[model samples]
Target: MSIVLIDSGLGGLTVLHEALQELPHERYLFFADNGNVPYGTKPKETVRSCILSAVQELVTEETKALLIACNTATSIAIADLRRLYSIPVIGMEPAVKPAVELNRNTGKRSLVMATPLALKETKYHDLVNRLGDTEHIDSQPMPGLVTLAEELEFDGPRVQAYLQETIGDRDWQEYGTAVLGCTHFSFFRTAFAKFLPPHIELIDGNRGTVRRLQELIRGREEAPDSAAAAGPVVEFRHSGSDPAYRERMEQALDWYRRDRERAGRPRA
Candidate 1:
């Protein structure tokens, strides 16, 4: 049994990276629906169907829990997933609540960078509305970052050009924090930190999501047995099932590891 992390592409590796750091003893199954990659641009029903189909293919009696690591997929299909599955179903959302709290009384807004489909979702809007800080929440659709991440372009002249083109003109002084709403965007945190004003802090939901998974797993009635205790191992799979793509997944993980090391961020 393993905690399953699903995404449209390699973005969920960000979540898995965090999980491995925090819950090092647990096994993980990372499923990337790369055959139907980029769910952020698709229609709501289409994204939902793809997510449901992929989840159906991945979930099993041995599956411990499911984490929809893609913000776009979570916005579109988390409800259906929760209803259909008995295991704990965790979903991603922009860390708007914490961003809002952090900016409270700071006279600064939070800039949320996500994909078009995710930003357009009612779930995203409802979250901002529920927080009652709609005026202070700004959203920018970053569909390109997902493509760049899938291509393994984390940082370079091309990445810098893209980031600059997207946000170069903005007045960073008006924002207290920038939220990496999409998991793919987390890959470029280093780039974002360097480009944005030093005053603006970067935030994401990856750590929070992993913490939720820990709480749920610990709350479970069953005790850890041999199967559960066997691993900090990760089994990677994708809808495409291409050996090349699997290699890319491994490469992405390695990239993330190196990125963290370069940033001097603690792994555990």
Candidate 2:
């Protein structure tokens, strides 16, 4: 059985990339709803519908688990999807809990950078409220970053300029942690590191999400229906008919691979 990862666009590749490192032998089916890209800025109902439609298209008897890798989609449709599916349905959330913990006693706040719609969702708010660190948590809408990532604009003058315009004015010293609430934002880690204060650390939920997936997969490893491939394989699909999206996904994966290698962390 294949593990399914769904997102509106290329953002979920970040999570998929992480999974590749840890679950190198697992089969993966990555479904990108490229036809309805940028779920972040869309209406809640519209985004939820798009996510459900994509999930419906991807989930099958051969699917072992489902991961909603987009923060916006997770915020809007994860609960409904979980109710409808018996598979291990995992969803992404901002790494707010860890970020808050990191900032504790440091007199520094944790900044959450995500899409506007995600930040507006009650799920996001309730997460923050439940943490009971409202005073030390701040959120910024980064819809433009999603667009840039979809366009494969990782780091360049345009990306730098956009980052500067969006967050340059902030008092970086007041923030000890920056939670990448959107998966797309992970692609811009280089740009953010160059722009944000050196003291500010970046955090994301990809690792945690992948850990949850590993747990689910482990639980089913001995099941009678469990299937294993000769090696890890990733099948990329999208809602759009364009073949270019497949190439784009490959390119993004290559970029991530090269980036990790440069950081002395080669793929498993």
Worst 10 residues of 1 by lDDT: 219-228
TM-score of each: 0.95, 0.95
Task: Write down the TM-score for model 2.
Answer: 0.95
Report the error of model 2 at residue 103, Å: 0.9
Task: Give the best candidate by lDDT.
Answer: 1
lDDT of each: 0.89, 0.88
Model 1 pairs in collision: none
At residue 120, what lDDT does model 1 achieve? 96
How do the residues 220-247 of candidate 1 rate in per-residue lDDT, one tens digit apiece?
Answer: 5355567657757889898885779999
Q: Assess the local accuracy of residue 10 in candidate 1 as a C-alpha lDDT between 0 and 100.
A: 93
What's the lDDT for residue 85 in model 1? 97
Tens-digit per-residue lDDT, 156-216, candidate 2: 9999999888888888888899999999998888788788877888888988999999998
